[model samples]
Target: MRRTSARSRISRALAVATAVAAVAGLTAYQGVAAEPAARTLAAGSPEGYGAGTTGGAGGPTVTVTSADAFIDAAASDGPLQIQVNGTIQLDDMEKVTSNKTIVGTGTRGRITGGGLNVSKASNVIIQNLTFSGSDDDAINVQYSTRVWIDHNDISDAYDGACDVKRASDGVTVSWNHFHDQDKNALLGHSDDNGSEDRGKLHVSYHHNWFDATTQRNPRVRFGNPVHVYNNYYYNNSGYGVASTEEAGVLVEGNYFENVKDPYHLGEADSGPGSLVARNNQLVNSGSGQTGGSVSTPSYSYRLDPAANVKSIVTSGSGVGHV
Candidate 1:
């Protein structure tokens, strides 16, 4: 299906709302329908955006406490503030529009049972939410730009906990926790769909806690120059980072504990990507395979020692009080 523009979608939604109000002889509802939300958010900065990206600015704040309300708010156009005050369990994927800030109010505000899909959206921020038992990916970013997924607890998904593909760029996935899950994260899905994902899928993953995930801490495919740093991996039953499809992955400053296979350039050297591993600390883990070099990250961020990564991540990563 052809993607509809956010403005056009909003216009249609407002028109429907107005028509409904008119049919009900409630004209006053039109005056206060889907107004611009007001929000103060730091812009997203990745891939040449110096200070990061901005999202859903100058809009009204909508506090959603149920699945239907959350879906309604997410369907609306951006510059929107969506505050989740409690759990919103869904039966399907919720499409999030452009320029949106979806944050949890506290530790208990979470999205469970279903998931969120951000496709063809720009300037989105998702933070401080716990997602589990989702029928699909906990959070999927496809063909999106300037997205930040931070401080969320994602696990037990039917698919990947967090998956980024389909030419998504300018993204940062940081400070999250993944435990007791398989197919933890995937940068690119299909090896044949390289036209849309070959030069894109630029993402920075840092300070995430991968605990007991069976595999694919992040299975990379055709995502060149993926910056993965300062993450804590513990008791991983499967390999940590697999760089396949000629992707250049810079895996650095991470702590791997009791992980059999930490990092590899490709699956048994079958693919063509390269990996650069340096200054990392490993305990009871296989030495990661490294061959190729990747480009450095765009912005400068503080990274603690590999020895301190486990402690810092265990103490700070995941939902609640982030």
Candidate 2:
């Protein structure tokens, strides 16, 4: 993927924010179900406090209208707060951003077509937005660092719900609700640019809930080492987590229910570097049992000892679990 300069990335973010604002009339718009107290949030109170600086906190609130305005605002020198009211559609959202924060009216603040595409930007935060019914991913990042996505509900995405792709580094995806998403909940990497033939790396996904009716949770691909922990998932068509062709992964303490397939670690590089699974709880609720593939690590690279799990409660395991 082509890398965007810092200036251009910020510019694109602001531009989009501006256009979205105008279409939604969020500048003075009030939520139809907004509570009276929620309208006037106290300035210094935690409820309605402004977003901060690029690295700090405290920034101006801008509404999204046109894509250009959104890009420009997100690239501003300081932190930015984006309030999404209506649908923000994009012809192409390959824009990168730095040090901006976006919020929406829960899941109702719809950004339908344009994904919050970020690559190689740093210190960006997105919170409280619902990315709904998009033909593409709700939000995607490539080569970005220090980005946080919190409490945003993304679903019905044509591809992955959120992809930390192409070696994007230092991203945290947490507390978001997801359902009916295809592909993975979070797809990430760990190592550096291995070969130009492959892709860049660096990303982490944690604490997100996935209610997949058709697909699975996530796959650590292209040696992208990611940390998966404490998340809940159900009715996935695939594994809870798998290292498809990548390595340096850690899966710990996650809860799974009615997952059609539990875990699979194949097609990864021969070395132990490509896969690691431990301390994850996978239970099939229906009559179908949990089905997966597991092998002892090669003695050369077996670092962490895999734990034998005792079935907790009358858990299902690919055996009539369905």
Candidate 3:
């Protein structure tokens, strides 16, 4: 394991102090009471199935400003915190190994012309970054466990913005802004891979801003007890969530504005799955199709009010907000 440098520790401490003071000042100036401590897990923090996910928490922190440095730090062994400081350009998807925290510096961190691949890795966190113009999916997690993807701006990817497939379990996707793209998020890869996918792919999708995205506000397959809650869907041209290939999905407490299809039980070529839709607010949206029985989540979480989901998601999602 790498050791934290004195300069990095001091910088991190000052940053934390600055953020605390800013938050306090804002609350005092607005005359609004602070949110409950439990609400801290609502956006940036990992919860639900990924509650145990800790990425490079006790590892050394290294700042990377170029593609070469970023790639080197990501592929290094053991626990590590890789801070992206500026736009790092690449030609294709790059690998991120196990036990890594790849976070952006303020709002200036970005990855363009490429994306990240977390293949066969575990305990990874990717947060507070802007990703655009990727040659492939903005973030691809396959055969990975305990991964958290939060508070990022993802758009214009060649494929899905975030795709978790091939038995990726204990995953959480939260507080991300997905816009101007098709195939926004996917939870499974193929319909015939149930041998490897069955009884796995447990994921939590919450507080994500699906803004004008076309389809696959996570099209899921063979993932039982997949929880989708408190998400905001606005002006989506295609649809919201799709549960197919015998998957079980619980969709609840979401706000859908001007979306034709908020969620459904099946999709093209794939057999119908099980879905339970509850407490979702649909404004000018079609009533979604549903069938079969879905399982309840084992973890505990606080749900934001459906009526306030739009405001909460838009204000807190994307880079620099966390």
Candidate 4:
């Protein structure tokens, strides 16, 4: 059941804050520190296909508060960690190059009006940012590899909050709060691009809070073993995860509340795919459709119990919470 009381929510938030403060020498997201830490994947590192993603680690950290400065830093050459300190209003979809870590500072970092384009790049990280009013996708990854997107709050984008397509591989989208948006995350752009996307587009979607989002809590295609696990879904108007165009998805250990259509094998104009659902907890939600055999994820990671997913995700997802 959903914890609707304000007192309960405050207690949970306070408990989470206390736990974060106990971790020593980690980063701002974990505890208070004199200097910001370098870019690193939190805790157990990225699981599933993005297991080895390490973005902009061992690089000089540069803080950017203006749009021009952020854009310049994002497109600069070599490995760099760009720390966003305030709202950066962008004019268009800004291009980000390889070996970059773009992270928000505390809860003040915000990206508005435009979005990020990770095109043909590799080893990039985007974390702890608030993305809204995007003219395009809040984060678009195309032809990229080994990218990790974590701990972001995304909403109000004209296009998808995050869209990964065009043969991107080894990507992880985790611990994000996606709400107040129509289209959410998507994988594999087109039905005709199977030639380029047949063996690619492998992604992991885990531990995210899909709160009242309409649809596409990723509508996927051509990604085998797309791992969707330990996520919390609440009051989504449209369906949750869609595995279309012969993709294979594993929906496991999730907590779904008031989502009528949770997971399915196909979407509009797309043929049936393969899906496996296991150990999911549904409250006032339908038992999602499933069929065919899905390849097991090769990476090893611990799974949080489905009963605790609401508290776990709500406490840890979005900016400033890491």
Cα lDDT tens digits, model 4, 83-120, are: 78889999899999998888888898899999999999
Better of 2 and 4 by lDDT: 4
Ranking by TM-score: 4, 3, 1, 2
Q: List clashing residue pairs in candidate 4.
A: none
Q: Cα lDDT of all candidates, in order?
A: 0.78, 0.51, 0.84, 0.84
Per-residue lDDT value at 240 in model 3: 94
Question: What TM-score does each of the candidates earn?
Answer: 0.85, 0.64, 0.87, 0.87
For model 2, residues 151-182, the per-residue Cα lDDT tens digits are 66677777777877665655556556777676
Which digits, one per residue and each the tens of the lDDT, describe model 1 over residues 114-160? 99999999888888888999998899989898888888898899998
Q: What local lDDT does model 2 show for residue 51?
A: 19
In candidate 3, what are the lDDT values of residues 1-322, reduced to their tens digit?
Answer: 1123433333443344335533432121111111111112212459888887878765555566667667666776776677777898978889999988888879888999999999999999999999999989999999999999999999999988999999999999999999989998999889999999999999999999999999999899999999999999999888999999979999999999999999987899998899999999999999988888999999999999999999999999999798
Error of 4 at 169 (Å): 0.4
Clashes of 2: 60
